[model samples]
Target: MSSLSPTSPPPAQSHALLSYPSPSILLVTLNRPLAMNALPFQAHWDLSELWSWFDDSPTLLVAILTGAGSAFCAGQDLKEVQANRLQPPSQPYLKGRPPSGFGGMSQRKGRKPIIAAVNGVAFGGGFEMCLNCDIVIASPRAQFALPEARRGLYASAGGLPRLVHGAGIQIASEIALTGRSISAEEGIRWLFVNRISKSQETLLEEAITLGREIARLSPDAVIATRGGLRDAHEMAGLEETWARTKERYEKKLYGAPNMLEGLAAFMGKREPKWVVSNL
Candidate 1:
């Protein structure tokens, strides 16, 4: 894909390193490697702001999230939580993370897609975030676990239900209750992980390739198609979700400029130029 025009970009942040690896792809690397990329309370808000910008940014279509070192994310920072226990109840730290859940992902239904390039350990809250992401590409060394139960904390960040949806009740229960570590191979077996790369060296490259495939298509179509898929996964019934998806995207997508361009390009046997999606 060709480079795109820049829009108002995200501001600098303390816990994250954000860069545009490609014109349509936003790469966010968790910078707290010493802490195993553990998200303290405030990092949640910081990332929430970033993700909001990515969703709204006309130049960006996909986001790739990975950790700086060998851990994608260790989940929430327990030490910070423990320290906050000593603070006064009136303090803001006591209020907990925003309604978006851990790292603004565990419970997010964002507009754009986020692909998790699982480079290493994804434990607790880290694993939770992956459960909600649109795609997950794991490294050979990648391991996922819901060890929060063993730590006297349930995987309360929406991972439990989503796990059951992907891995079934018995499997989800066994993993959650035992807190056993699941390797990348086993993750694919349980149908949680999309696939593992050949090695850690090529993990990010593989993820970016897949992101580009999505980015190359009509932006409006991709958004609406993704929304429909998510609705089927998260909403009530098949018919109801289909009806809702039609009402939400059918007219707008079929009538958009890109819609005409796509059809004309197809008939003319040429490449279609997509406009920034307003959907």
Candidate 2:
């Protein structure tokens, strides 16, 4: 239940968004309720900093991102964009433009897991942000859409690509082309969301539970497993990928302190103490 103020320290801000640290999880919130937790120019930068902070934090094994108010995020602040003051070439919109991808979601390569707790509507870039998460849990009122198509643009910041990869090309095409929203139920049905909860509190509780479970595992094993999956997806053929994986497994992760701890804990009937180390 410990909380950190928005303007507390480095990588922290005084705005609506806040970052709170738990034992093994970092909870980041979009705190602008008046604007439905919309992403302002500075908010994007804050997000990038948040991701970077999490990447270097060894105690933080997982992160849970959610909105402060009822709405998760209405997407980019169109007012700022229209005024020509939103885009920062420096941050690259925190996307994969030059530095990181949009909101730092698309280009992040951290080993820690991220879970998106969709409290309400996740539209346009908001939906794209959810797509970047490793897992998504939504409230029953949560709705997802890529409405950029209707506005003469497209959800290019990993939305189209991730949707196609997660929910299949045909379904992603339908959603993008039609600019229609899908309910939490429909999202769960399509496997786009892992779970639908009764409320935001419940959704976050479940996400934190999952995060703690992940934290209990050996950190090295978790990171290596994520790398293996990413490699398998990027490369062709399982033969070559598995060969490379075996080499890394033997030469690196296996026989590590965590592995020995796991074995000893099993033999001694005690809880395993996972040794955290930077990879």
lDDT of 2 by residue, 1-279 (tens): 112222224386534455454476778787877888777667666677778777666666678988887898888877767655545446554332324455667556656678898999999888988887888999989999999989999887767877887789888988899999899998987778998876766887887788878777777787778767766855678998888767766566777788888899999999888766446
Off by over 4 Å in 1: 1-5, 88-95
Backbone atom clashes (below 3 Å) for every candidate? 0, 6
Lowest-scoring 10 consecutive residues by lDDT in candidate 1? 86-95
Q: All candidates' TM-scores?
A: 0.96, 0.87
**lDDT of every model, 2 decimals:** 0.89, 0.75
For model 2, state the Cα shift of residue 39 in Å.
1.0
Query: How well is each residue in 151-264 modelled by candidate 1, as lDDT tens digits?
Result: 888998999999999999999999999999999999999999999999899999999999998888888988898899999999879999999999999999997988998999
